[model samples]
Target: MYDHRKLGRELGLFDTDPLIGAGLPYWLPDGAVVRHSLEDYIRTVERRAGYQHVYSPALGKRALYEISGHWAHYDEDMYPPMDVGGEQVVLRPSLCPHHAVMYRSRSHSYRELPLRMAELGAMYRSELSGVLGGLTRVRCIHLNDAHIFCTLDQVADEAAAALALIGSAYRAMGITDARYRLSLPGAGGKYVAAPDMWARASKILGEVLDRAGVPYEAVEGEAAFYGPKIDIQVGDHAGRESTLSTVQVDFHQPEQFDLHYIGADGARHRPVMVHRSIIGSVERAVAHLIEQHGGAFPAWLAPVQVAVLPISDAQEATAARLRDRCLDADLRVRILSAQDGSLGARVRETRLVPYQFVIGPAEADDDAVAVRLRDGRRLPALPAGDVIARVRALVQAHDTRLWD
Candidate 1:
């Protein structure tokens, strides 16, 4: 098993400084590269699914949470309020309330039955110090948050479509065996407004899950205060389970905020809300990726795709040109030319990186380069252009691991 916390620090991915407090991650340059790639991946997938991206402030007035029922049920996880002038303000712990306000901003007709909104929003939660563990459990998080507002008649179809989107994302990450758990509020858990509403929402969501033929176990008492949810759970190498994604069915918030739309009959009807996060928090996903791949990420996701090495100082010019070509192809490349070390030692050093490209004087004259894959496979003397194209294809396919 790979110890990700140690690897994160050693690889200069992120660090937790004493002065920065617990549950916070300070990302370095390499770590930022990984984070950006993750955001881009999610954006591309969500856009293809017709989600309109939006942005909201990181902080809001205290009353916003109160109206959303978060202040009443989840206040313990929220930060202390700031007295800005005469009003109280708090950092947003979740994006749902903000999305609710956005939904209420315009009058809607039945024609817009399903409206999808997405945001890569930063959120802050005041977590207990003991529960904090590097990027997996942080005080600050960038959430792949999305909300779907649809008419009651369209709820089942929209939910099924969201599930498909989540599955596609997990499959891309090489986590295909994730199990679904339908989480209903338990007798002891905090449920929104009334018990009957909780049961109704859970039943509706479960019916949709069944109709979609999704295999899931009904888990009582795991639901959020405001709704029932479908949790996507996956096990790590140690057999420890974690939530990779969630689709929550919320009935209380729409009524609480008086959100409504005009139906074909000209009657005012409340829209059903679906809250989802396919990748959960970006920080936790990064930690998961590090552990799942044992610090050796796939070719596409690896920070440095190719580390260029020259056999001797005489080959430095050629190596530099190769690095430029790789960079022009939008591939992350590193150049290492060591005159004092043996070629074997140089290769070993380059191996520390995920991919290595070794070019010597002979290959330079031949207009070819030697390729060394991450898993120790060597392809002798391939044209530089051919190698670039192959790498580009691998990246486009989201094949992070090498093709054996």
Candidate 2:
């Protein structure tokens, strides 16, 4: 059984201090590398998919949540409002409200319909102490969140594209074994009192699931307050299920915020708000990934993508040259010297590194280095440039294959 909390500590990925309080674990340097890599990858993917990124304040006016229906529905899970400069402000529990405000900031036209706005933004949740066990549940959340303001007619296609994007991201992250769930409001929760809106949103999401030809379970009371969503669910080591990604169709927020766009007919029309997250939250996603790969991350996501080992002092200069090359190529690399341990021990210590270039006397004399892959595959001495190029290529491609 692989537990992320245990693996996280052992791998020096993250740590929590008593003074800092629970549910607020800070990332170590290596963990930050993993997270930054993931964030950069998401940004690249979002840009390619036509998502315009934005930055928003983590704190919002108390009225903002009230207008978005979050204060009324999700206040229990929210932090208490603080009086800031004679006005009440609180940490935002969701990014959708702020995003709604962004859309309403400027008028839109039919040509800009389906405008995808994305942000790797931070939000807060006042989770209980007991539930705050690791990165899975936390007070501060950095979410890979986005909202698409589209015409009512374009809702289905946008939702479908969001799901497809999530699928592709999961695939690239080596995440399989996740199940789809159509999350609907149950009869008992503090749901919005709009049955017609709920029905429309649920139907659109259901059709998107059907058109995608994927099997999903329709679970009740698992939806957001204002809409229905498709959740990509994954299990932890103890067989506990949690949502990793989601695509939701929301009609209530647009109405709440009075968001509109001018149509081709020159009349104002409501733009549907489609909420989607490729990865629900960076902390939780990294938690699952830590357990999934057991800290042996793929080449592109690996914190130390390459380790250069100098067998002895004789090859220290050679190792330095190789390390510089790796740094120039934008690879996360480290050099383990004989002072750390023997050549074999250094290799074993950095077992999680995707590539290890062993610099020995003969190899240095030949202007080459022997290669050792994480999976125990050893290659003969190859040109240092060729080795660096190969590793750089794999990292760029996000390919898991060590050598080809």
Predictions in order: lDDT: 0.84, 0.93
lDDT of 2 by residue, 268-381 (tens): 999999999997899999999998999999899998999999999989998998899999999989999989999889988999999999998989998898999999999999
TM-score against truth, every candidate:
0.94, 0.98
Off by over 4 Å in 2: none
lDDT computed for candidate 1: 0.84
Q: Alpha carbon lDDT of residue 229, candidate 2?
A: 97
- Worst window of 10 by summed lDDT in candidate 1: 395-404
Task: Give the clash total for candidate 2.
Answer: 0
Best by TM-score: 2
Give me the displacement of residue 123 in model 1, in angstroms.
Answer: 1.4
List CA RMSD, all candidates: 1.9, 1.1
In lDDT terms, which candidate is top?
2
Q: Write the per-residue lDDT of candidate 1 for residues 331-383, one digit (tens) a residue.
A: 89988786747778867766646667888888889878888887888888889
Q: List the residue pairs that clash in candidate 2.
A: none
